[model samples]
Target: MTKPLISTERVQSSTGPMVIASVLNSPSERTSAPHRHARGQLLGARRGLLTVAAADHHWVVPATHAVWIPPDCVHGLRSHGPFHGWSVYVAAPACVDLPGQPCIIAISGLLREAVDRAATWGEGPMDQRQERIAQLLLDEIAVLPAEPLGLPLPLDPRLRRISQALADDLADNRSLAEWAQWAGLSGRTLARRFVSETGFSFSQWRQRARLLRALELLAADVPVTTIALQLGYDNVSAFIAMFRRALGVTPGRYFIAAS
Candidate 1:
């Protein structure tokens, strides 16, 4: 569970940079409110999925994936399920040549530990070794893989109505053609608007929405088979295949590794 929203404060740290703290909760515990920060942020989700809206793009970050938010960029953070994480601040002046896009980086065991370990030390200058370690950690961040969790949904009223109906019934198993008919648009028009406005095809967006719901269900420790059925998959294997393709790991593995 998350505590109430609190004001953002920059705390003086042992090093030259200031540290900021923010808490994340499960999707059921909060609503998505978009915002940004003054300093670069290392968004760590110890559990659940984190959906971040940065600029015109939105990213769904699962466990083992962290979003590196650059300074002065507007963004929103929301929990997809029971979530616990940290927002570590790195002063902007020291950040250089960082990827400008909202990034989804795979967390190495060592880098994850460094975050905690560095936090444990008091405000002070790091020795030569610690500074080197910090630089290496930043280097790892630059190469993180971009996960394909974002699904663009158009803002058209007719399309939105149809999309909302599908969201209301994720288990409907309706094809794009069916939705197009319901929206009173041809299949080509539906596909075109989906790509033009949302940057993804109708089929791709539906799969992501289903996957997003699946991650939330899994985080709540809901049974895999049950979640598979709930998301309209014919069987657990089919769902698992989709899940692995999006995340590069199995449901069980993701859950266990996250734990």
Candidate 2:
């Protein structure tokens, strides 16, 4: 959780569908609080991992991916490593073609160049050339494909506690009985309530937690073998198998395709 070199609040100014790009060097472990934007935004990181949490949905943005956030959706971010990124903001009226909800998008070379060219835009008025670039940026973003890599968070307090515990230590591989004991609940009650509240059993929830954590580590470009050991998988192949099961592609192929 190194302090973020750049803050979102530092670049909230956007006029007439502007693509405001910013470079964030390793951000703090957590955002100060949830914040909103007057206009819809597509936040893309040129490097590092960017995680966005809003309502029950949590999105993890790998270096080659971007996130589309609807206007007025209160969200927070947690960034890892030196993050170079862009925030393309569109006036609400201009957001008709944008995604209606939060989404993780794949960024192509063309879109990346468009964003890089527009990152220089500040609060100052855009000239005709800049205006044209903004329009083109929006057009490029509209065609990018979305990746279903989001982890849904549950609201129940008990389920929330489990999520928080896993977030603090991705390496934890404690037994379910031990976890329940720490929570001071009988195993049966814990097991039953887990599914009732989160619609996922404890084991399933743990797998998801590990899956999400793997993404952050992968975004940092950690070696797959190291990531496997760190996430409590027995070996590299095991980790790759799990990742493939969830994402439908091996880790290396996933990034290659995404990039």
Candidate 3:
């Protein structure tokens, strides 16, 4: 069973150009509200999923990915099932090379272990060996790529209503015309407005909303075929193709990487 949100003050209060690992077990809870840290944070789940949202963007994190949240970024996390994760915090000035904007970053083996080990350290400057590892971690992060894996929310109420409906059920394969009717606008007007406000056409945005829900189900060990059908895919292969296109790998491979 999950417990209440874990207190993060220990990691929050640490000093220096430091890296502190905060571990989370499976079936975890959520932060009390939107909050910020003075230092940058890399939030990753090694064994489960974490839903993180900030600045109108939301990411559903399977174990394969982590999010880079810049210093003072207001964000929050929610976990529904089991997971083993870490919150790796780095002091501000030192986090310069890392992204200032929130991003979804794929984690490599060395970086993951570095964070796992850092969880055991104290608040002072690292020893030579520790310093070496810290440098390597930063070097890896500097070159690491970011994934466009988040679903962005729109400020417009019409778009917001559609987003909410899709969040409740990703299987709604509504077309532009259908959505426009619901929004009380014509199809052409709705299409243009959606792209202008959300940077995604109605179809693209709906697909991402669906994919985000699929990710949560996938992390829970739900079968891919079932997820495909549940999300309104024509068949398993089609869903796999879409998943690969969005994630650069097939669903099975993606979940394996997460594991």
Candidate 4:
């Protein structure tokens, strides 16, 4: 499938304008290898889901959210299906006041509209009106609230082994003790190091992994019952409850609102 027209080398040049915006439309799935740009980027999907991975952080960006990638951050992108979105690239100097790390931020209506308007501009220096719109976009990004759609990965090799296993098989219901033994670490060490490394207990991290997976499956139009079963949930109600607790809305309602 064809990828979005974002070039790291082109966007990162110091001589480029302060902000560069582009609209993305893909009829099928697309994937970009891990890469870095000297320019920071704000990427959001308007009609589908995007999975963005940067360093040890992974974010599931729905239509209502955007992922901010700081300048020179190594990252990759994978679209869940057809994708229609926008990307705004900022010069390195202009990113000094923006987010210092990769995160998923809630996209406000004003920011969305501003980006849409900016995406239509032709190449070259911006006019006074365009400059004002660009500033507005930057202002909105600086203050937008971050959403809890990111999963932090652990740094320890043993912990990564366990984490990767869980990600590969969300239905794995191994207890902390079982996982510790499997990884050749003591249960206490596993629990403590999990919190220290990923800022989440083992169980909490697994739940978050499941939540993120559910979102990917949902974007592909998976049935709720099937998703619950696939994620090892005993019933659909339990899965829905967990999703609602994390996102403050049921799965159906969340996607409905996003659409």
In model 1, residue pairs whose N, Cα or C atoms come closer than 3 Å (at least 3 residues apart or on different chains), thus clashing, are: 14-123, 14-124, 26-81, 27-81, 35-75
lDDT of 3 by residue, 1-259 (tens): 2332224564355466466656766553444367776777788776544667765666556566788888878887765354567777777767888886888877788888888777777766789888877777777677789977765667678876776566555677878899889988789987888788778998888787667667756766889999999888989998999888988888878767665
Instruction: Compose the digit string of candidate 1's lDDT tens values, residues 125-200.
Output: 6677667666666666666566555544466888867665665567888888988898898999998998887777
Q: List model 2 lDDT by residue over 88-202, tens digit each.
A: 6677666778778788876767777777777666666789998888788778767776676554555656656666676556678888888878877778887888787666788
Q: Model 3: runs farther than 4 Å from truth?
A: 1-17, 26-32, 47-51, 55-62, 79-84, 122-128, 161-193, 212-223, 244-259
TM-scores of the models, in the given order?
Answer: 0.66, 0.76, 0.70, 0.67
Ranking by lDDT, best first? 4, 3, 2, 1
Q: Candidate 1: how many backbone clashes?
A: 5
For each candidate, the alpha-carbon lDDT, in order, equals 0.67, 0.68, 0.72, 0.82
Expressed as tens digits, the lDDT of each residue in 151-258 for candidate 4 is 676768998788867765789888999999999999999999999987899989999888877776776688889989989999999999999998889988777777
* Superposition TM-score, candidate 3 onto the true structure: 0.70
lDDT of 1: 0.67
How far in Å is the alpha carbon of 226 misplaced in model 1? 4.5
For every candidate in turn, the CA RMSD to the true structure comes to 5.4, 3.9, 4.8, 4.9
State in Å the error of residue 175, model 1. Answer: 5.7
Clashes of each: 5, 2, 2, 0
Regarding TM-score, does 2 or 3 come out ahead? Answer: 2
Could you tell me how far off, in angstroms, the CA of residue 55 lies in candidate 3 after the best superposition?
Answer: 4.9
Candidate order by TM-score, highest to lowest?
2, 3, 4, 1
